[model samples]
Target: MLSDIRPAIVSTILFTVLLGLVYPLAITGVAKLAFPYQAEGSLVRDSAGHVVGSALLAQPFAKDEYLHPRPSAAGNGYDPTSSGGSNYGPLSADLAKRIKGDAAALRQSTGHVQIPDDAITTSASGLDPDISPQYALLQVDRIAKARGAAADEVRALIQRNIQSPLFGFIGQPRVNVLMTNRALDLALPKGQPKRA
Candidate 1:
């Protein structure tokens, strides 16, 4: 009995140290060394050198002069602490109602252009920073009009910021809303109010 209990206790302690502590630390170290920018949360900064937001997480942009990210369901929308989908089923009435409302509003704003699904749907994490290139293009006219810039210039900006798929294959092309908004600010200098 003593032998069995002693070995079991020893194994628990050894495994705890190895798996719980050493493994995590080792992986973190390797990640930090190998992918320093990503390991540090991919934070974006402003012109004044202050941290603005992360390149990886979505933040809301309601004003007309900037591109909006996908609708967030995270606590009050885009709250990192509450990142998650609404979990509405495909047949759910509530989901359909919301999508209909969003689509209607988007059509009214963007002159009835083809609506991309990403423009109306919340991402699984509810905090995806990237929107489809099509969705970003949809907002170009609105943003350009608001900023009092030419549509072609704004379209060019969006085109320049379109990120390619990871390793050119793993994911779809996306436009990071925060990065592009920052670029919009830099390129147009609209003096728009800052958002989180």
Candidate 2:
């Protein structure tokens, strides 16, 4: 019985060291070496060299001059600590009401253009920094008008920022709103504030 129990305990310790500590450390080392940028959270920087945000997480951009990301149900909107969907089911009256309010606000802000569904819906993570191309296009006019730039120029900026689908077919094309907006800020002349 003593011999049996000793071997069992020894094996348990060996497996724990192998699987619990060594495996995790090995994988982490490999990931850090192979994908340093992503392993470090994919942070984005502004022109001033200040870290602004992470590409993996979304932040609120309510001002009309910037393209808006998905509606966040996360705490205080885009709080990474609370990243999650609203959890309201498709048939939930609360969900319908929230969508209605969001749609109404969007229509009022963007002047009755055919709003994309993504424009009004919250993403599953509530921190998706990317929005559909259609949604990005929908906001171009508003952003251009607010920034005092020509619509064509703003459209071009959006076009430039449109990220292709993974391997050209896995997911739909999307625009990283933060990157596009930062590009807009760089493209426009200094001291210009968004009008509406």
Q: Can you give the TM-score per candidate against the true fold?
A: 0.89, 0.87
In order, the Cα lDDT scores of the candidates are 0.91, 0.86
Write the residue-wise lDDT of candidate 2 on 1-196 in tens digits: 7779988999999999999999999989999999988988898876666778987788989887888899998887899999889989889999999989999999998886588989889888889989999899888788888878899999988999999989999998999987787788878743654321
| Candidate 1 least-lDDT 10 residues | 187-196
- Against the true structure, candidate 2 reaches a TM-score of 0.87
Question: Against the hidden true structure, what lDDT does model 2 obtain?
Answer: 0.86
What is residue 69's positional error in candidate 1, in angstroms? 0.3
Off by over 4 Å in 1: 29-35, 191-196
Q: Model 2 shows how many backbone clashes?
A: 0
**Can you write out model 1's per-residue Cα lDDT over 126-178, one digit (the tens) per residue?**
89999999999999889998999999999999999998988999989999999
RMSD of 1: 2.3
